[model samples]
Target: MKCVGLCPAFVVELWGVLEGLCCVRRLGFTKVELNTDSEAVGQLVKEGRVTSLLGNTLAKQRKLLEFDWIIDISHTYCEVNKCVDGLANFL
Candidate 1:
């Protein structure tokens, strides 16, 4: 994990997913299930939609998704994401 300084919450969330994906790839994992508490980011990824602020990053994410691996992106409740919150806080 690394500090990204300050940025919009959406960007931070997207960055987390990107980093998580990269980590999984580096770890030689061929299948992953990525969960996010941010509905906007999840929805955008699921629907393959892009925004001005996230177009490039989202495109990169899409490319990562195209790799020869299975990935599932899901939106979950924040309450169900406490473990991640705890880990983030620890960092």
Candidate 2:
């Protein structure tokens, strides 16, 4: 397993987990993984905050060989209020 992103929250949440140790290292991967282009990991490395091998970018041609999963979400909220005597109540 390999992790390619620099998401601090994800890294922190993953800490102490066996999967956290398989972070991307030097462009080669033993299994499929996830990554992002935010550059957070690179900055961490430059600041001496992190010490680990990084991965190289895969070619465009290689991208077609991989599968991608996408997700979408929608949210809504509702509120109501009632007036009783001189006091206003919310529900």
Candidate 3:
């Protein structure tokens, strides 16, 4: 986890997804299931809604998706990701 100072929650969530994708790509993973607890980020990615605020980040995410791999992005409840939640809280 990284501290992003102050920003909108969606930005932080999307950035985390982007970073994770890049890390997985570097690790030569061909298939990935990405679970995010942010419903707004999930909806934005699923609906392809590119707002001015999120356009660049979303574009990067889209490009990453275009790579030769299988990627599934889905929304999971925070309760389902207790470890991540605890880590975030610890930070």
Top candidate by lDDT: 3
Candidate 1 vs 2: which has more TM-score: 1
User: Where does the lowest 10-residue lDDT sum fall in candidate 1?
Assistant: 44-53
Clashes of each: 0, 2, 0
Q: Write the per-residue lDDT of candidate 1 for residues 5-84, one digit (tens) a residue.
A: 78998888888888888899999999899999898888877777778878987888888888999998888887878988
lDDT of 3 by residue, 31-79 (tens): 9999999988887776766788779888888888889999888999989
Provide the global lDDT of candidate 3 against the true structure: 0.86
The models' CA-based lDDT, in order, is: 0.86, 0.28, 0.86
Those runs of model 1 whose alpha carbons end farther than 4 Å from true positions after fitting are none
Return the TM-score for candidate 2, rounded to 2 decimals.
Answer: 0.19
Clash pairs, candidate 2, are 26-54, 27-55
Question: Least lDDT summed over 10 consecutive residues: which range in candidate 2?
Answer: 71-80
The sequence of per-residue lDDT tens digits that candidate 2 reaches over residues 1-91 is: 3454565543532231223223322234444333222245323322333223222222221232232422111111112212221131231
lDDT over C-alpha atoms for residue 45 of model 3: 73
